[model samples]
Target: MADGASGLGDQARAEAYALPLEDLNPGDPELFRTDTHWPYFERLRAEAPVHWCKESEFGSYWSVTRYNDIMSVDTNHQVFSSGAALGGITIRDARPDLRRPSFIAMDPPKHDVQRKTVSPIVAPANLAVMEPIIRERAGRILDELPVGEVFNWVDRVSIELTTQMLATLFDFPFEERRRLTHWSDVATCLPMPGALCETEDARQAELMECLAVFTDLWNQRVNKPPAGDLVSMMAHSDATRDMTPDEYLGNIILLIVGGNDTTRNSISGGLYALNKFPAEYDKLRANPGLIPNMVPEIIRWQTPLAHMRRTALVDTEIAGQPIAKGDKVVMWYVSGNRDEAVIENPEAFRIDRERPRQHLSFGFGIHRCVGNRLAELQLKIVWEEILKRFRHIEVVAEPKRVRSSFVKGYEELPVVIHA
Candidate 1:
């Protein structure tokens, strides 16, 4: 639901403002599902940058809402741990027996080493190598679209491009590439009675199948020489080679979600945001060179993957608010991205900002997104290709957003291309 809807956004805004600061639960997935989470975050940022929620669906947690405060919390990894033992990165805590440790979810030493193993995939040389491939693939995807007919942009372009690239990264089977998308969604989704995933047990069942499939891939790759693909890299590298079965699955989920959701949603969000702010679209069409800047601006505007949660390793005070030991501290990147103190006109989707990249979307410090540059490159290439073929991509309807507050993304965006 877009803001300023007759009842939804205005009602949410009123409730958000009227609620006692301590009672506000911005992490509620329902708010995000309806796109009404904005005003709640806005209230927290303005009134309680370091607010405490005594209760939530996840549990009691501390919210660090401002830009600098989030930076402080994110960078100070020693004080705030991302260990799977404490709880993984998102607001949702996994069951004790199911806690799987990925590089992004581990503390230093192990986290550093495993992250380094796959870092080469997105290095400048690798990105340079992949640019032409991305551009060519993006062109083909766009070229095939019907000019006058409406289609779901999320499935047609966003999912197709990100999944294709993710398949290439993992050297996954081309025909079953959509499984990557499915697994990514399943990994971040909340298990509710009426939801896509009915229960935790059902979710685990699907994930086990993912592990089994990847296990086959791993077994096939282990005896071979070291290769460029992620599976081969993990199979060969000392840092990742001896990982436990659960650790292996954790890293696989991280890679799939990292490589799939962020870029995929941003691709859809860019078109949708531009459509929201038509002048920005006009500016982009007049000067396509603004794309490099526009890409990050869209990332900032979208703030895909809204928040990253960390468990307090020790007693710490964030912005003068005391956070006890073992407390969950959630850095609201979606809120921070809109912190007026840092970003001028934080709400507007402007393509030409003096410093468009100066926002906290991919995150900060040691745990920052490893594939951020790749995400930017994918978005840049798609838009570059899009501007070449289509005069406009008109939003046929309001996009269906993913329900989870963590993975801020689109489920579907209906649109018609004007060529």
Candidate 2:
């Protein structure tokens, strides 16, 4: 059932079309885990780009399916709020006692200043400086991989590479960098019986541990001269230096997940997309110069971190569908990225598109991903290094995808390298 860019079989596709429009609930995490959410989104974009669901496990919400409608909702933050107090930015509402404030979940002046503190880490000059370092590390990781034996690419390359980069940015303990990955997974994964943490209390306990470890690092850097790391940047900045413990943990989880999950999943997703569309893989192999363009296209095809939610602060209408005050509006970026009306031949994964960055993966508006440039740089360098070393990194099996709808990523990707 694990698939990306694979055909939804006839029966599955029919089931999606056969559903009563009222029964469509794209927010279901099971649909994502099995990679069968495409047909439902396809139906929505065609039939009701701004559809209403009277009920769902996450409670009733409006789904904005097309590209322009999503843009309208994402950019007009005044009408659509992301305040943590207003239930934050995801479909799942955090328990009242558990919600914490982070810039992505805040609006206006506070969001502006706090975001500025972390923005410099991904600035052009900084990205240029980090490029060679990323390239060198990427080479080392690829060089270490076994050629003939199958291994989980998600663990071996994707996670290791992104975790190393996260450590570099945070100046986190070298050997303990994997802890960042664990914290990120715990932050986003649903607390179901088989998931990372089975209870919200257990999840909170682990997050507290994360806060404790980062608090120690904060102490170390608070008194020292300001340095280049994210930890130091926040410790020195007025906007975030005095954040409450809960607020600090909120931002930490945001940064860890933002910096780790998105890029690592894209790293894994890009490889999976290419393997799924072998013609594109051949195109990449034929023209290594295309890596620059291919990076963004791969991101478009994957659309990691599927949907970002917002709460309507006032009455609004998207695609003529009425949304009242306090309504939860979920922008389906996964669907928008594939809207045929927006991109030419979106269903086809081509490496050399003329306008590869036009997709909505990084989103549009004030809350657009802060570390987006860093992500692109990481992917570009990784692919560049990959093309130099191997003809193909064959996906020997369908990826074992993560269970949550929030984090559209792989838990495992079995693969073997061919020289």
Candidate 3:
């Protein structure tokens, strides 16, 4: 467990320590919301790296907690399918009634073709084009921060910047950019009070609105010359151009959620992590050049999206644990990022770690995050711009974490920026 786990309530810590290893259910959303899930995952990694929970809110699922075990499952996508027809790439099974099919939840050949269609948007060439724009936005965001006053960094800085970048990617209307964030939230949120929606029906209706809006964009772009934007790329590519309405909507949700959550949360998480480890923040202040290397470390520490699930296509064993066909196998990237066997001093936040990118925050195999380089590029530029302007960004209160085991991120982070 990270040293920060010590900050958990004494009774909670005692309970975590006393609980039987088999009784440790790491999927509990309350643990994540309270930011006290570390001890549960710590116990899991120590006792049963490949453990099964007979039942839970999502249903029975197997958790692969350690680093190598997660790698084995993540790399072997053939054995552990990501198909929506099977169950999709989340612990929760896809609804048979409301099936939204996207490439990430697809098996290869089809997955490969569709993934290739949008690959160029985040390619090295496109990221190079995007760098200046990202830096400019980062600078403006930082410059506008209220000096020595409390503000929600998650909303003002993280969401705003990432949403702007998402707008640029899809050539979305700047005025209605918040809708992208709303749809992204609604897609992943578990439909609770204070969440994006309060019911499954509400989630679906908002997503349908998202589909309608994007469908208009698709119609407009499909008739024009091919351009560099993501919508344009999808409209022009033979592999993706002919997608059905549901498939198109699914892909849009996938791209929007992918574009919004990871980077936005990491932006917020990086600051929070630095504040939690003041020494690391001091190291960053002293040597700003570490920004490039530190970005991946932040991603590793944050492990933005906690886990990705795969349904077993056939009987398989992960680390000696037999997984029956159709069983849900969740590769807990959150745990793997902290596995002591793979990461040296996994608890501490160090800016100058060797092999910083050697983390599973991005999954392995063909389904590795397509926008990874773009994400890293955004973080690097933001940190660089922040260093130039601010002397320190202090976390004034505990962040209000999103109440979902899946999207491990902040809903709000109160901070005071010092120039």
Candidate 4:
């Protein structure tokens, strides 16, 4: 029985390695949903760093798989544009009729101006101010966990903490904070049965409701004195104060997803990964001081946002692959984080790595995540508090992953705490 099982495993591994590059579509939602994307990306990184997919659910797009190649494309925003008008920033081209314009989707002066308007919300000083609140909430959530009983950590811990933080950032109504999670999920999820929304129209309708709710907040903020929250800052800032309704909605979606999904998923992913590598969890337990270092390592391993898509502004060649003007280019940050060339034992999840933050989880250059420092701060505090409270938070089963290529995250993680 053991030999037969070993042979089956060997066959699976061999088939994964033998998957034709032409057949390797890394953007498939099913691959991510089933957590079978690693082998496909590993195969691409090894063989075709800058691979072109002739067809996909999102249509033809070029995949930039290597670490350095992704950096080159990411940093050189001039040649590769992130403009919303040019299909926005996803493998799925923005619908001409349903164009949503946000600053992250803009290039040059506009992107910088609008980004600066909200940057202070996550500025170092502000993060210090927010740290205690985050820690307090994390502690409360951990304290509330049902001892020795199976529970969904994704909902109880990850979503609860991140939703609270998102509410704090927007100064949003605490009771309605789960709305933000719904909106974020709606914005990123594919239109499929059992997903967040089964139709594009349904997704847009929910997002429109999101816009209406935030618009009320925007109005209230604009009429009042400037405050530290993201909505207030945007209302008061010259660059974003006069944004079009669509632009405002787009930015709101960006911030909601940025604030919620990345951190929430990482919180869940970190525990899942540690459980996968128990020795690393033992190392973490042996030295709680490694929490800060381990935070980035977890982010690197989880790669909360799988890929950031850009449009080729001019005909350009990336790693010798010719990319034409107006072509969709996807920088697979997930693959780059695992690229063996840049990271030693890239597949291993080591908390004490020499350079934990060296990976591409938070893309480089001007568009690097503004909330990255804040994200790290929250994760670090959560883990620190977790260590003080529990001996082990055991993952009872494989996590139910979100069925989307963009927002790589968990839908559920069954866990039990052992004190």
Question: Between the candidate structures 2 and 4, which one is better when assessed by TM-score?
Answer: 2
Tens-digit per-residue lDDT, 134-222, candidate 2 = 99999999999998998999999999999999999999998999999999999998997878999989999999999999999999999
Cα lDDT tens digits, model 3, 1-419, are: 02444557665767888977667778878888988888777878988889888878888899999999999999998899999888799877767977778999999989999999998899888888899999999999888889989999999999999999999999999999999999988898887776668888888999899999999999999999999988999999999998988899999999998998999999999999999989999999999999999999999999999999999999989988889999999999999999999999998888899999999998999999999999999999999998888888899888889988889999999999866
Cα lDDT listed for each candidate: 0.93, 0.91, 0.90, 0.90
Q: Least lDDT summed over 10 consecutive residues: which range in candidate 4?
A: 1-10
How would you encode candidate 1's per-residue C-alpha lDDT over 154-189 as one tens digit per residue? 999999999999999999999999999999998998
TM per candidate: 0.98, 0.98, 0.97, 0.96
Residue-wise lDDT of candidate 4 within 207-252, one digit each (tens)?
A: 8999999999999989999998889998999999999999999999
What ranking of all candidate models by lDDT puts the best one first? Answer: 1, 2, 3, 4
C-alpha lDDT (0 to 100) for residue 218 of candidate 1: 96
**Where is model 1 more than 4 Å wrong at Cα?**
1-7
Error of 3 at 43 (Å): 0.9
What TM value does model 3 have?
A: 0.97
Candidate 3 clashes between residue pairs 3 or more apart in a chain or in different chains: none
